[model samples]
Target: MQTTGISYSETSVRGRSRPSSFRQRFKHSASWLKGVAVALTLGSLLSGCGVVNHMIYKTTGDVMQGFSRDHTIPYLMASGDLAMGCAMSEATAPLLMSFGRVTNEPDQLAVMLYLSAGGCAEEQGREHELAALAAMYERKGNAAEDAIIRQKRAYSLAAKRYLKGWQHHNTYYGEPGTGECPDFDDDMDEFIYFAGLLAGLQALNSEIQSTSSIGVPKNVGSVVARASSCLESDKWWGAPMALKATVWAMIPGAQPEGEDAFERLAMTDRMGDEAGVRLSHVFHAIAATNKGDEAMVKSVVRQHAESLKEQPANEDWAFVDAMATNMIIAISDRLWVENTGHRTPLGRLGTFWDDQKAEVETMDLDGLL
Candidate 1:
């Protein structure tokens, strides 16, 4: 009886040991699973930060792009302050451009901004050109050479900015006049397209002026000339025809026989004036300057000034009129500076330093004093 009791006790002990071993194995597995879960959670958190950052950056980029297209561009277009416009473009370009990393680039805005910035640099180049010319007139050989170098440097910078604008325009719109002009999303889109053409033309012009190999396409002039036809000359305030005409006048063999470039420019000048947008005068002056026809440039500037006096600027397009005025003034200033070693005097845009003084009886100022 004692032996049997001992055997039962042994069986009970074995059964208890089996359960204890099973519990130990289950506890170990649970602990392993917990550790794996913690590791995965930490890993996911570290990686998820990048994903979250990407999303946030993309959203911000999109918002900025939208705001620029909807509000900023229109405001700048409507404002007549060319200097302010230039400043705005230069100041905001880097911040705006950096957003391209996480989102689509604001290419249309880039076209306008770079174009404006290039204009600012071109203005500086013009100043240098005037200084160089004045130095030559004064027989200051070293000064003239130095001024020329400065002018070329400014022009090279202008060319690079303008070419960047042209590149962005091409990337956004594809080659202008691709199968046909791409359907413009709106009037603003059409305007942007027009701006792009101007950018390309300016790029080529500035590159030539720089006397540097800027890689601006030599064919850009012809391309712009052809692309100008895509815009309605009348609808865009005669700018398109003026651009085409300027290109025709500038490029060799570009003007179709019997279709006189100057004649077309004259017609467009009238069209521009009648439309209350005097942009055509700019083209006329540019063509005349390129031809070295100082008389014609003077005539164009005089006509523009007279037109301003006769007609109130179109309220809706006042900014464009103001831009034309600014460019004309720049040209007039160039002439004045070339002759007098200074820019045009206040309220003397139409008159030159050499203009004949109207016959006046000499007042004896000494006796009066």
Candidate 2:
């Protein structure tokens, strides 16, 4: 038969042309491969973007942390404004603390910041407590009850925040009394270490006052008492010894043989007066209060008042002197409220309700103002 011979490439069977299956398969595979390549490129870009963002965040954190520690802290320490310092600390803590998320954790700064904030809350609690006691003394039962609630709430917050500070301190320096003290970088470093110890002890005391189960370690006081020896007490204006002695007074059997807490406190009292930093007076007064020696507490307050007039606060460390003065005023206010149902008069810190008439003492109001 004379049938037309169709070429194999173009041949059709059953009235339909057959396409090249291999060529179509190859084209589909190439298209799929192109999509995969695009996806990989996009993934790489996204990953690189994440890396860049992290680097920026980390660098910013470093700068902010460094500036805050080096500049902000020094400036605050030099200024004699406790209320302003407290407000700044409370307001800026969360902002500064957020930096830790994008970079290395700022445990050292955290120790100081939380300690300051806790102190603020503790001060508020103290005011409320004084008010409650005054109300009770005056027979205002409902007001006394309300003040008690506010005082406990403030104390609970202080306890929690102070405990957080202690935790960060432990993270930065290792747990106190667990091992040898770290080699501190500078005076400020050592000061921060001491502050951390104070924070730990404050955590314990605040928790007790709050009457809450805040998980403050029972041994924190003992640990801090031992750790106080790590610092140069003389350079720190007797604060370390004051801390240790206060611990001895508070904790039964904490005092060692041949070591009288009161003698140490007396020595610290002189050191602080000479240094124009009377933080030791606060410690001495606290010990006296714990022993229920009201006269001694008042005596410490009187001594601090007289010292302020005898010599001006150290210009280089005005903030510390101011802090000590503020604490002493708080004690005086408590005494005043308890007995006379009022805070210490605006300028009458050293005087009391039953004091014999004497020449008024003058003081710079840097601490109060």
Q: Where does candidate 1 clash, by residue pair?
A: none
Task: Give model 1's TM-score versus the native structure.
Answer: 0.84
Q: Residue-wise lDDT of candidate 1 within 1-369, one digit each (tens)?
A: 245532221325534644456667999999999999999999999889989999999999999988998788887777777788889889999999899989998898899889988988998998898898788778889999999999999999999999999999999988975557877898889988988998899999999999999999988988898888889998987889999999999988999888899988999998888888899999999999999999999999999988888887776567678888988998998898778777888987777777877888888889988
Model 1 ranges with Cα > 4 A deviation: 1-43, 358-369
Model 1, total clashes? 0
lDDT by residue (1-369, candidate 2, tens digit) is 665865446456776766577568989999999999999999999999999999999899999889988888888888888898899989999988898999988888998899999999999999899989899989999999999999999999999999999999989889788659899998888888988998999999999999989999999999998898898888999999999999999899999988999889999999999999999999999999999999999999999999999978987678889988988999999999899898999877789998968889999899898
lDDT of each: 0.88, 0.91
Quick one: best lDDT, which candidate?
Answer: 2
